[model samples]
Target chain A: MTQPPVIEVNGLMRSYGGGRTLLGREKPVIHAINDVSFQIAEGETLGLVGESGSGKSTTGRAVLHLERPDAGSVRFRGTELSTLGQQGLKPYRKHMQMIFQDPYSALNPRMKVGRFVGEPLVVHGVDSGSSLQDRVAELFKLVGLDPSFMSRYPHEFSGGQRQRINIARAIALQPGFIVADEPITALDVSIQAQIVNLFQDLQDQLGLAYLFIAHDLSMVRYLCQWVAVMLRGRIVEMAPTEQIFADPRHPYTRSLLAAIPVPDPDRVRPDRPPFDVAANVPPREAPLIEVAPDHFVLDHQVQ
Target chain B: MALLEIKNLTVEFDTPGGVVHAVNDLNYSVEAGETLGVVGESGSGKSVHILALLGLLPCPPGRIVSGEAWFDGRNLMALSDRDLRSIRGGEIGMVFQDPMSSLNPVLTVGRQLKEVLTRHTNLTGRALKARMVELLDIVGIPHPEARLSQYPHEFSGGMRQRVMIAIGMACNPRLLIADEATTALDVTVQAQILDLVRQLKHDFGTTVIWITHDMGVVAELADTIQVMYGGRIMERGPVRPVFHDPRSAYTWGLLNSLPDEGARTQRRLYQIPGSPPDMSNPPPGDPFAPRNPFATERCHREVPPLRDVGNMPGHKVAAWYDLPALLAAQSEKEQTP
Candidate 1:
């Protein structure tokens, strides 16, 4: 007997166009995600993190075919997603869904919350009538939304509430894996915890796997068991959470961890790394590098 | 004496939803050469308290109801607008979150930097231009001479922040109010900005009041921590005890809920339940009582004042329970397989 991994991305690649250099030749292509590979066992959350150009978001989108990959393959539940035809992939979308960071743009302003969530099921021909409404209420209840507020528009809810609606819609089809992209960054600090806890509760109850993409190291550390650090479209480091923090072998990882301002004054390092521009030279290239066990460093490598 | 001492601060705002209490009876002080980190979730009033220092918040919707913002022995709160303006940069500088928005899109970086120097230092013409280049270079903006003519958008997010820091230091003010200064930057750049702020504080002996919701920042830069909730001080003390053995349940939940590398074993974030109280209708008891696990009848019926836990050296926490024991319990819970 065998159980399939929830989601698997192997050797995925993508790029953006580059501006011309001073020498009047085309600049090196931007590697959004290059040869990235990872897996999330069923019900596990794998965190993706990095700076602005790190390509973690691109990888998530590429895995879902929201953004096409330049090369490589993505498999979900042993079915080759990259090889699936456009028509073939539509049905599989029921098993995978994505949640975006911006709650304001993610929801349909014109449609009410009930209709918005039920749209997917209606299109998929899953349910209609009282059963659909019941399912919508169930979905709302499942995501901790008040069923009474089903008819309300997205504007009636706060940022946190809107994100809950987004989650309800994502899970409407009972997807096994979800890519939650920065779902709480725009939320209030106090409200962020509620949403995070809700995500946690949902994962436990449904056995859902999450590719939690975010930049907050502290938050990611809490939600994800295995984390993959990306920089310029390359997976710089991938590891179990404890080892990465306890012994961050990569210099970038060390610097990232060290920079977390410890709130404890007594714990404040008496000596701090000097802030010198000499450190952080605009990468003469890209993809810092693989240095140790499940850790990668991006010092300088273009694509 | 402390360089800045704020006592009895009570700022109010006449929002459409009635008089909103923003900062309520805030009392804290920063030494001449020390950093104070004012931490809280949004609407906890830390930002208002800091902004009230400079009289920056608009008067129509916001008003300082009562307070003594004594900086170097002068009452900044009661000072006239003109008087406050005179001291805003001449004695104290302010930097805010969102460098993208805080910076003027049309203005050149050099112009903004030089304006501060000219306003405070009585410099002009070539002397001022030279000073601007010098200031840019000092802030680690490479090739300051060539870069001076470039507009704000031309620079990267991190570089723009450095420029803002240079402008803040232009007057060499005794204090800098960095309200979420590095929240917009990435981790690498955030470190750089934090390091830069610390270095500037060290080099110039400038007192810093960093107002942010980020716990990591409170951990990294604060010598002292003040946790705010419901427009009042929930706890105030040195940073170590606040993180290690916080008495306030709100503070405890905040620390636990924050994700970090060490917490991979925990499948989910230990987020504090419920929403922050509506300020207009703040509960009579502990603001965090609704969400707090250890809250009791007293916690629900009456507010817990900032009671001195007085356990660790120089540590102070405000809570009804034996928080030290709670912290031990938390540690044990986290340690379990």
Candidate 2:
């Protein structure tokens, strides 16, 4: 536990569209992410879960520096990245990569599979010529894909296979950390297991840290050791996966857990209050209080 | 008589890849007021079967190869387009996956509801206006009168879906077909819509056909479940027995792959080994045999027929393996140190 964190984010904040409108009136600003802070240790998976518009995706992007935040600092391997210029941040880009939810739109359609996977290495000036082909083949094999299909286009592959390609691209640079945003949501049940397992295997083999952002609790629990529940751009609860599932403190977290339809017909879920009731309540000014060992809950008094 | 009955229904789509055998020899029935949940992944032919029943499949590329769809003592397949039109919106209601695309964007919510009311009923003038407001209120939309004047774009995603539900249930149809109606909404909003559907079913005794890929949603809402894979019904039975004691290996795989929130087991998920078969040219034998770990020689040679599982009434599975032998083998495997 004494090892330094792989990525550290402190008091991160981001907003969208506060400028004047075409009618010369001021437009309303949407605080997409507010005062978010988290740490991902080396070779660990940290899950950020929330529904649409909860800013979970924004938090993932902000940490990876894909979308710059308006305030706060992102420290990667003890190096502050928030103030780095574009050229200064270039070297750090290879240490982190992102995978998106939709595989169809993520990859360029016109490019061949080998070219797409090798593009990262080419850009980084790490491998070239015959070595690039070898590296692409190696990546394809690592992700459980057939290396012979390098010449095929993305259209020829199914949804799950396309996701594997996305994973291969994310790891092509051998980054120490990766941010996966809803990586398996678009896949089928059988294929989801394949991708999720591949992620675990890759993480162990490469000693990679992951920031897994998703909306499904079951998948998050399966893949992550620690989970942070976000609501309306704020972290309401942060705990180990077991504690979050077994003993959720926040009312919003409890309702979110209850809303998950368990796949057992004999056990019907007891009705709970609508989640918005808790979301509509104002946030407490108090800081996150540790209720149990390493389990933090937002100190908001519920009505 | 059952509200709707289908036997040996088959549909094919002439795609560039070849003729896709979408629905093959599908047989199922829904009672007057019961809810039937159809579960399947994409390209499993669940949606196509419903579209075929409603006569919505385009003719050139899509053809009802052969089948008899009996609804209210009438063979729906034999009915003319003119007859099917009335049956579609009058006796049968449908809600689709995307609420935004289903509703007319430019039309005020009231006009759309009034059009359906006018087409299927004798109400007119103030009576029509009053009925429209009542329909909106029944679906749990706030400020019903104000919502009626607003366009579809003015409402949120959940509200638009509620409007779609109101339009579908406007005539109090005997059967309601909802195809992934809540897949687009957030979990909280999905729960609300689900609760609303359950209430409507109780109040009006409306038969519901809810099709989705999520087994959790099916478990929460359906009284009976029909699992479809590769254009065929793998298993169909009462929800409780199907979950407790599955007869089909495919169903077992589907259940095992699902990550349960209740118990966090320290084991790898039981994944179905391969992808779903290409439907354009389906294999000669059972479509699931390639991926099924428990597949037998018979499964690779011939298609399994739906038969009753042991003494459980109304439970059927299209599998060659006996349930007792599979269960015994499974327990033996588990017991091994």
Share of real interface contacts recovered by each model? 0.76, 0.61
Worst 10 residues of 1 chain B by lDDT: B259-268
The positional error of residue B270 in candidate 1, measured at the CA in angstroms, is: 3.2
User: Number of the top candidate by lDDT?
Assistant: 2
Per-residue lDDT tens digits of candidate 2, residues B1-337? 5899999999999989999999999999998888999988877899999999899989879999999999999999999999998888788999999989999999999999998899899999999999999998988887998899999999888889999999999999999999999987777778888888898899999999999888889999999999998999999999988988888888888888877665567456667787777899787777888888788899999999989895568899999987658879889999996
Query: Model 2 segments beyond 4 Å from truth?
Result: A1-3, A277-286, B330-337
i-RMS values of the candidates, in order? 2.4, 1.4
User: Model 1 clash tally?
Assistant: 16
Docking class of 1: medium
Regions of model 1 farther than 4 Å from truth: A1-3, A17-31, A82-86, A109-111, A155-158, A246-249, A268-303, B125-127, B259-269, B311-337
